[model samples]
Target: MKIITLTFFSALAISVCSLIGPTSRAATGIGDECNKGGDVKFAIREYDNKLVSVCRADGVGDCLYTKAFGKTFVDNRLHLNSDRLHDYVIKDLSGSYGDNDVTHFMLFAQCRDGNFVKVGDDFFTNLRPDAMDRTTGWLKLRVTRDCYNDSISDTQERSYTIVFDPKKRRYGPPDSNPKLTHYCSDAELALPVGSANSSR
Candidate 1:
Protein backbone atom coordinates (compact mmCIF):
# COMPACT_ATOMS: atom_id res chain seq x y z
CA MET A 1 0.00 0.00 0.00
CA LYS A 2 2.82 2.45 0.83
CA ILE A 3 4.53 1.84 -2.52
CA ILE A 4 1.27 2.36 -4.48
CA THR A 5 0.45 5.57 -2.61
CA LEU A 6 3.89 7.04 -3.29
CA THR A 7 3.60 6.20 -7.02
CA PHE A 8 0.16 7.82 -7.24
CA PHE A 9 1.41 11.01 -5.55
CA SER A 10 4.38 11.19 -7.89
CA ALA A 11 2.16 10.94 -10.95
CA LEU A 12 -0.20 13.58 -9.56
CA ALA A 13 2.68 15.97 -8.94
CA ILE A 14 3.98 15.57 -12.47
CA SER A 15 0.50 16.22 -13.89
CA VAL A 16 0.09 19.37 -11.83
CA CYS A 17 3.45 20.74 -12.86
CA SER A 18 2.73 20.13 -16.54
CA LEU A 19 -0.55 22.03 -16.37
CA ILE A 20 0.89 25.00 -14.47
CA GLY A 21 4.05 25.48 -16.48
CA PRO A 22 2.50 26.45 -19.79
CA THR A 23 -0.23 28.52 -18.17
CA SER A 24 2.28 30.58 -16.20
CA ARG A 25 4.46 31.19 -19.25
CA ALA A 26 1.51 32.15 -21.43
CA ALA A 27 0.30 34.59 -18.79
CA THR A 28 3.61 36.44 -19.15
CA GLY A 29 3.64 36.89 -22.89
CA ILE A 30 5.67 39.70 -24.37
CA GLY A 31 4.23 43.24 -24.12
CA ASP A 32 1.80 41.90 -21.54
CA GLU A 33 3.76 43.85 -18.94
CA CYS A 34 3.61 47.16 -20.76
CA ASN A 35 1.57 49.87 -19.12
CA LYS A 36 -1.42 50.79 -21.26
CA GLY A 37 -3.29 53.80 -19.95
CA GLY A 38 -6.86 53.47 -18.79
CA ASP A 39 -8.18 54.65 -22.13
CA VAL A 40 -5.88 52.51 -24.20
CA LYS A 41 -5.77 48.77 -24.90
CA PHE A 42 -3.10 46.71 -26.61
CA ALA A 43 -2.94 43.38 -28.36
CA ILE A 44 0.36 41.53 -28.46
CA ARG A 45 1.60 38.88 -30.84
CA GLU A 46 4.84 37.41 -32.13
CA TYR A 47 6.01 38.31 -35.61
CA ASP A 48 9.30 36.89 -36.79
CA ASN A 49 10.05 36.06 -33.20
CA LYS A 50 9.74 39.72 -32.16
CA LEU A 51 7.00 41.12 -30.02
CA VAL A 52 4.52 43.14 -32.10
CA SER A 53 2.17 45.20 -30.00
CA VAL A 54 -0.85 46.93 -31.50
CA CYS A 55 -1.94 49.70 -29.20
CA ARG A 56 -5.20 51.64 -29.44
CA ALA A 57 -5.67 55.07 -27.93
CA ASP A 58 -8.97 56.33 -26.49
CA GLY A 59 -10.29 52.84 -27.27
CA VAL A 60 -11.56 54.21 -30.62
CA GLY A 61 -11.03 54.37 -34.36
CA ASP A 62 -7.79 54.62 -36.35
CA CYS A 63 -5.31 55.72 -33.69
CA LEU A 64 -1.86 56.79 -34.85
CA TYR A 65 -0.23 53.48 -33.92
CA THR A 66 -2.93 51.52 -35.69
CA LYS A 67 -2.45 53.50 -38.88
CA ALA A 68 1.27 52.85 -38.62
CA PHE A 69 0.56 49.14 -38.94
CA GLY A 70 -1.45 48.95 -42.18
CA LYS A 71 -4.89 49.50 -43.77
CA THR A 72 -6.36 46.51 -41.97
CA PHE A 73 -3.80 47.11 -39.21
CA VAL A 74 -5.28 44.29 -37.17
CA ASP A 75 -3.49 41.12 -36.08
CA ASN A 76 -4.40 39.28 -39.26
CA ARG A 77 -2.78 41.88 -41.49
CA LEU A 78 0.43 42.23 -39.50
CA HIS A 79 3.39 40.84 -41.44
CA LEU A 80 7.15 40.67 -41.15
CA ASN A 81 9.61 41.02 -43.99
CA SER A 82 12.15 38.42 -42.93
CA ASP A 83 13.77 38.36 -46.37
CA ARG A 84 15.58 41.56 -45.53
CA LEU A 85 18.05 41.39 -42.65
CA HIS A 86 16.28 44.16 -40.77
CA ASP A 87 12.54 44.46 -40.00
CA TYR A 88 10.34 47.24 -41.31
CA VAL A 89 6.92 48.59 -40.50
CA ILE A 90 4.64 49.97 -43.22
CA LYS A 91 1.51 51.85 -42.28
CA ASP A 92 -0.78 54.81 -42.94
CA LEU A 93 -1.71 58.08 -41.18
CA SER A 94 -4.64 60.46 -41.08
CA GLY A 95 -5.28 64.03 -40.02
CA SER A 96 -8.41 66.06 -39.41
CA TYR A 97 -9.28 69.34 -41.11
CA GLY A 98 -12.56 70.75 -39.82
CA ASP A 99 -14.95 67.85 -40.53
CA ASN A 100 -12.73 66.18 -43.08
CA ASP A 101 -9.96 63.64 -42.52
CA VAL A 102 -6.97 63.11 -44.81
CA THR A 103 -5.06 59.82 -44.84
CA HIS A 104 -1.54 59.01 -46.04
CA PHE A 105 0.76 55.98 -45.88
CA MET A 106 4.45 55.48 -45.09
CA LEU A 107 7.17 52.87 -44.60
CA PHE A 108 9.68 52.75 -41.74
CA ALA A 109 12.71 50.53 -41.92
CA GLN A 110 14.69 49.49 -38.87
CA CYS A 111 18.31 50.59 -39.08
CA ARG A 112 21.39 48.81 -37.79
CA ASP A 113 21.72 51.37 -35.00
CA GLY A 114 18.39 50.12 -33.55
CA ASN A 115 16.45 53.13 -34.82
CA PHE A 116 13.76 53.37 -37.48
CA VAL A 117 14.03 55.42 -40.67
CA LYS A 118 10.96 56.59 -42.56
CA VAL A 119 11.48 55.33 -46.10
CA GLY A 120 8.23 56.08 -47.93
CA ASP A 121 5.35 58.50 -47.49
CA ASP A 122 2.52 59.25 -49.90
CA PHE A 123 -1.22 59.37 -50.36
CA PHE A 124 -2.80 55.92 -50.60
CA THR A 125 -6.29 54.57 -50.07
CA ASN A 126 -5.59 50.97 -49.04
CA LEU A 127 -2.60 48.62 -48.78
CA ARG A 128 -2.13 44.85 -48.76
CA PRO A 129 0.60 42.33 -49.23
CA ASP A 130 1.37 41.36 -52.80
CA ALA A 131 1.57 37.60 -52.35
CA MET A 132 3.01 37.19 -55.84
CA ASP A 133 6.14 39.10 -54.94
CA ARG A 134 6.20 39.57 -51.16
CA THR A 135 9.21 37.25 -50.96
CA THR A 136 10.82 39.72 -53.33
CA GLY A 137 9.75 42.74 -51.26
CA TRP A 138 6.73 43.99 -53.22
CA LEU A 139 3.40 45.34 -52.03
CA LYS A 140 0.04 46.16 -53.61
CA LEU A 141 -1.74 49.38 -52.74
CA ARG A 142 -4.93 51.13 -53.82
CA VAL A 143 -4.34 54.71 -54.91
CA THR A 144 -6.89 57.44 -54.37
CA ARG A 145 -7.00 61.22 -53.94
CA ASP A 146 -9.28 63.62 -52.04
CA CYS A 147 -11.26 60.68 -50.77
CA TYR A 148 -11.44 61.96 -47.23
CA ASN A 149 -12.47 65.56 -47.83
CA ASP A 150 -16.01 66.84 -48.30
CA SER A 151 -15.33 67.39 -51.97
CA ILE A 152 -16.00 64.32 -54.19
CA SER A 153 -13.41 65.16 -56.85
CA ASP A 154 -10.37 62.81 -57.26
CA THR A 155 -12.07 60.04 -55.32
CA GLN A 156 -11.29 57.55 -58.03
CA GLU A 157 -9.55 54.33 -56.98
CA ARG A 158 -6.53 53.00 -58.88
CA SER A 159 -4.17 50.09 -58.38
CA TYR A 160 -0.51 50.80 -57.73
CA THR A 161 2.54 48.58 -57.39
CA ILE A 162 5.35 49.38 -54.94
CA VAL A 163 8.63 47.57 -54.66
CA PHE A 164 11.30 47.64 -52.00
CA ASP A 165 14.70 48.71 -53.25
CA PRO A 166 17.23 46.95 -51.03
CA LYS A 167 20.17 48.81 -52.49
CA LYS A 168 18.66 52.21 -51.76
CA ARG A 169 17.26 50.79 -48.51
CA ARG A 170 13.86 52.30 -49.31
CA TYR A 171 10.68 51.55 -51.13
CA GLY A 172 10.74 52.70 -54.76
CA PRO A 173 8.19 55.10 -56.21
CA PRO A 174 4.79 53.62 -56.98
CA ASP A 175 4.13 52.34 -60.52
CA SER A 176 0.55 52.78 -61.70
CA ASN A 177 -1.28 52.54 -64.99
CA PRO A 178 -4.05 54.93 -65.96
CA LYS A 179 -7.38 53.17 -65.66
CA LEU A 180 -11.08 53.84 -65.22
CA THR A 181 -12.03 55.35 -61.89
CA HIS A 182 -13.79 53.34 -59.21
CA TYR A 183 -15.38 55.24 -56.35
CA CYS A 184 -15.30 53.72 -52.87
CA SER A 185 -17.92 54.52 -50.26
CA ASP A 186 -17.00 55.88 -46.86
CA ALA A 187 -17.89 52.59 -45.22
CA GLU A 188 -15.54 50.80 -47.61
CA LEU A 189 -12.76 53.20 -46.77
CA ALA A 190 -13.34 53.04 -43.04
CA LEU A 191 -11.22 50.95 -40.67
CA PRO A 192 -11.18 47.19 -41.21
CA VAL A 193 -14.49 45.46 -40.53
CA GLY A 194 -15.17 44.97 -36.80
CA SER A 195 -11.92 46.74 -35.83
CA ALA A 196 -13.58 49.69 -34.10
CA ASN A 197 -16.00 47.37 -32.31
CA SER A 198 -13.45 44.82 -31.13
CA SER A 199 -13.05 44.59 -27.36
CA ARG A 200 -9.32 43.92 -27.61
Candidate 2:
Protein backbone atom coordinates (compact mmCIF):
# COMPACT_ATOMS: atom_id res chain seq x y z
CA MET A 1 0.00 0.00 0.00
CA LYS A 2 2.79 2.41 0.86
CA ILE A 3 4.64 1.70 -2.36
CA ILE A 4 1.49 2.08 -4.39
CA THR A 5 0.71 5.43 -2.88
CA LEU A 6 4.23 6.66 -3.37
CA THR A 7 4.26 5.55 -6.98
CA PHE A 8 0.93 7.20 -7.60
CA PHE A 9 2.12 10.50 -6.14
CA SER A 10 5.36 10.34 -8.03
CA ALA A 11 3.56 9.82 -11.27
CA LEU A 12 1.16 12.61 -10.54
CA ALA A 13 4.02 14.92 -9.75
CA ILE A 14 5.85 14.12 -12.96
CA SER A 15 2.74 14.71 -15.02
CA VAL A 16 1.86 18.03 -13.43
CA CYS A 17 5.43 19.19 -13.66
CA SER A 18 5.43 18.44 -17.35
CA LEU A 19 2.23 20.40 -17.94
CA ILE A 20 3.37 23.42 -15.93
CA GLY A 21 7.12 22.87 -16.52
CA PRO A 22 9.98 23.43 -14.04
CA THR A 23 8.74 27.05 -14.02
CA SER A 24 5.77 28.99 -15.44
CA ARG A 25 6.09 32.34 -17.15
CA ALA A 26 3.09 34.15 -18.53
CA ALA A 27 3.30 34.76 -22.26
CA THR A 28 3.22 38.21 -23.75
CA GLY A 29 -0.15 37.95 -22.09
CA ILE A 30 -1.37 34.38 -21.50
CA GLY A 31 -0.60 32.61 -24.73
CA ASP A 32 2.35 30.39 -23.92
CA GLU A 33 2.61 32.07 -20.51
CA CYS A 34 1.62 35.56 -19.40
CA ASN A 35 2.66 39.17 -19.70
CA LYS A 36 2.33 40.80 -16.28
CA GLY A 37 3.00 44.48 -15.73
CA GLY A 38 3.22 46.37 -12.44
CA ASP A 39 1.36 45.34 -9.26
CA VAL A 40 0.35 41.88 -10.45
CA LYS A 41 1.71 38.51 -9.32
CA PHE A 42 1.92 34.91 -10.57
CA ALA A 43 2.89 31.30 -9.72
CA ILE A 44 2.50 27.55 -10.43
CA ARG A 45 3.04 24.26 -8.59
CA GLU A 46 3.00 20.52 -9.18
CA TYR A 47 1.26 17.96 -6.98
CA ASP A 48 2.81 17.70 -3.50
CA ASN A 49 5.42 20.26 -4.43
CA LYS A 50 5.91 23.75 -3.03
CA LEU A 51 4.89 26.87 -5.01
CA VAL A 52 8.00 28.57 -6.34
CA SER A 53 8.38 31.75 -8.32
CA VAL A 54 9.80 31.43 -11.85
CA CYS A 55 10.63 35.15 -12.13
CA ARG A 56 9.08 38.57 -12.52
CA ALA A 57 8.59 40.36 -15.82
CA ASP A 58 7.36 43.33 -13.82
CA GLY A 59 7.05 45.12 -10.23
CA VAL A 60 8.01 44.88 -6.49
CA GLY A 61 7.73 41.23 -7.40
CA ASP A 62 9.68 39.64 -4.61
CA CYS A 63 10.53 35.96 -4.82
CA LEU A 64 8.65 33.31 -2.79
CA TYR A 65 8.73 29.68 -1.72
CA THR A 66 5.73 27.92 -0.22
CA LYS A 67 2.85 25.63 -1.11
CA ALA A 68 -0.68 26.77 -1.84
CA PHE A 69 -3.78 25.09 -0.37
CA GLY A 70 -5.43 23.41 -3.30
CA LYS A 71 -5.01 21.81 -6.70
CA THR A 72 -7.40 21.23 -9.57
CA PHE A 73 -9.91 23.63 -11.11
CA VAL A 74 -13.11 22.44 -12.69
CA ASP A 75 -16.73 23.32 -13.35
CA ASN A 76 -16.99 26.06 -10.73
CA ARG A 77 -16.05 23.67 -7.98
CA LEU A 78 -12.74 23.83 -6.13
CA HIS A 79 -11.84 21.36 -3.40
CA LEU A 80 -9.90 23.14 -0.65
CA ASN A 81 -7.70 21.60 2.03
CA SER A 82 -8.12 18.46 0.04
CA ASP A 83 -4.39 18.31 0.20
CA ARG A 84 -4.46 19.15 3.89
CA LEU A 85 -2.11 21.99 2.89
CA HIS A 86 -3.58 23.82 5.86
CA ASP A 87 -0.93 26.51 6.23
CA TYR A 88 -1.54 29.02 3.48
CA VAL A 89 -3.52 32.30 3.21
CA ILE A 90 -5.23 34.17 0.35
CA LYS A 91 -5.90 37.79 1.29
CA ASP A 92 -4.46 40.71 -0.76
CA LEU A 93 -3.86 38.29 -3.56
CA SER A 94 -3.23 40.65 -6.43
CA GLY A 95 -5.79 43.39 -7.08
CA SER A 96 -7.15 42.59 -3.60
CA TYR A 97 -8.64 39.46 -5.04
CA GLY A 98 -8.10 37.05 -2.19
CA ASP A 99 -9.24 36.42 1.33
CA ASN A 100 -8.62 33.76 3.96
CA ASP A 101 -11.83 32.28 2.60
CA VAL A 102 -10.02 31.35 -0.62
CA THR A 103 -9.29 27.85 0.43
CA HIS A 104 -10.53 26.09 -2.67
CA PHE A 105 -12.68 27.70 -5.35
CA MET A 106 -13.30 27.95 -9.10
CA LEU A 107 -13.54 30.61 -11.73
CA PHE A 108 -15.67 30.41 -14.88
CA ALA A 109 -14.01 32.31 -17.75
CA GLN A 110 -16.01 33.38 -20.79
CA CYS A 111 -15.30 35.79 -23.59
CA ARG A 112 -18.06 38.39 -23.78
CA ASP A 113 -16.97 39.20 -27.30
CA GLY A 114 -20.20 37.57 -28.53
CA ASN A 115 -17.94 35.03 -30.24
CA PHE A 116 -15.95 32.26 -28.63
CA VAL A 117 -13.39 32.83 -31.35
CA LYS A 118 -10.50 33.71 -29.03
CA VAL A 119 -11.24 32.69 -25.43
CA GLY A 120 -13.42 30.04 -23.83
CA ASP A 121 -12.85 27.12 -21.51
CA ASP A 122 -13.30 25.84 -17.94
CA PHE A 123 -10.10 26.64 -15.96
CA PHE A 124 -9.63 23.68 -13.61
CA THR A 125 -10.54 20.19 -14.74
CA ASN A 126 -8.64 17.50 -12.94
CA LEU A 127 -8.27 15.50 -9.72
CA ARG A 128 -10.59 14.81 -6.77
CA PRO A 129 -9.65 15.99 -3.31
CA ASP A 130 -8.59 13.04 -1.22
CA ALA A 131 -8.58 15.32 1.84
CA MET A 132 -12.36 15.72 1.84
CA ASP A 133 -15.60 15.72 -0.16
CA ARG A 134 -15.74 17.25 -3.60
CA THR A 135 -18.15 20.06 -4.48
CA THR A 136 -18.64 22.91 -6.91
CA GLY A 137 -17.82 26.47 -5.88
CA TRP A 138 -17.37 29.98 -7.39
CA LEU A 139 -18.68 31.34 -10.70
CA LYS A 140 -16.99 34.12 -12.69
CA LEU A 141 -17.95 36.10 -15.82
CA ARG A 142 -15.31 37.81 -17.94
CA VAL A 143 -14.18 39.02 -21.37
CA THR A 144 -10.80 39.73 -22.99
CA ARG A 145 -9.63 42.55 -25.19
CA ASP A 146 -6.41 40.70 -25.85
CA CYS A 147 -6.51 37.28 -24.35
CA TYR A 148 -2.74 37.30 -24.00
CA ASN A 149 -1.97 40.65 -22.41
CA ASP A 150 -0.91 40.68 -18.78
CA SER A 151 -2.34 44.12 -18.27
CA ILE A 152 -6.02 44.12 -19.05
CA SER A 153 -8.29 47.08 -19.61
CA ASP A 154 -11.58 46.13 -18.06
CA THR A 155 -14.07 47.57 -20.52
CA GLN A 156 -16.21 45.98 -17.91
CA GLU A 157 -13.97 46.00 -14.86
CA ARG A 158 -16.37 43.62 -13.21
CA SER A 159 -16.23 39.93 -12.31
CA TYR A 160 -18.66 37.57 -10.62
CA THR A 161 -17.91 35.53 -7.50
CA ILE A 162 -20.08 32.48 -7.03
CA VAL A 163 -20.24 29.62 -4.61
CA PHE A 164 -21.63 26.35 -6.01
CA ASP A 165 -23.16 23.93 -3.58
CA PRO A 166 -22.04 20.34 -3.66
CA LYS A 167 -25.67 19.49 -3.10
CA LYS A 168 -24.21 16.03 -2.63
CA ARG A 169 -20.90 17.00 -1.05
CA ARG A 170 -21.89 20.04 1.01
CA TYR A 171 -19.54 22.99 0.63
CA GLY A 172 -16.00 22.03 1.65
CA PRO A 173 -14.81 23.48 4.91
CA PRO A 174 -12.77 26.68 4.76
CA ASP A 175 -9.39 25.89 6.31
CA SER A 176 -7.01 28.83 6.23
CA ASN A 177 -3.62 30.28 7.18
CA PRO A 178 -3.36 34.05 6.64
CA LYS A 179 0.31 33.50 5.90
CA LEU A 180 -0.02 31.61 2.62
CA THR A 181 -0.27 34.23 -0.08
CA HIS A 182 1.72 36.78 1.84
CA TYR A 183 4.90 34.75 2.03
CA CYS A 184 5.10 33.76 -1.64
CA SER A 185 1.80 33.64 -3.51
CA ASP A 186 2.11 36.99 -5.25
CA ALA A 187 4.72 35.30 -7.41
CA GLU A 188 3.40 31.77 -7.62
CA LEU A 189 0.84 29.39 -6.18
CA ALA A 190 0.03 25.80 -6.87
CA LEU A 191 -3.34 26.49 -8.39
CA PRO A 192 -3.74 30.15 -9.06
CA VAL A 193 -6.44 30.61 -11.71
CA GLY A 194 -5.48 34.20 -12.38
CA SER A 195 -3.53 33.16 -15.44
CA ALA A 196 -6.48 31.08 -16.51
CA ASN A 197 -8.77 34.10 -16.17
CA SER A 198 -6.37 36.61 -17.68
CA SER A 199 -5.75 34.54 -20.79
CA ARG A 200 -9.33 34.81 -21.73
Best candidate according to lDDT: 1
Report the lDDT tens digits of candidate 1 across residue range 95-182. 4333323344545433333333444555455555554343433344333333442454334333445655545444554442112112
For candidate 2, lDDT tens digit of each residue in 1-200?
A: 99999999999999998887633421111222112221232232223332322222233355332334332312222213222111111211222222212222222111122111111211111212332223322212231111121333321111111222333121221121222213123322332333423212
Cα error, candidate 2, residue 174 (Å):
17
Runs in model 2 with CA error above 4 Å? Answer: 1-61, 65-200
Q: In candidate 1, where is summed lDDT lowest over 10 consecutive residues?
A: 191-200
Give each model a TM-score. 0.36, 0.18
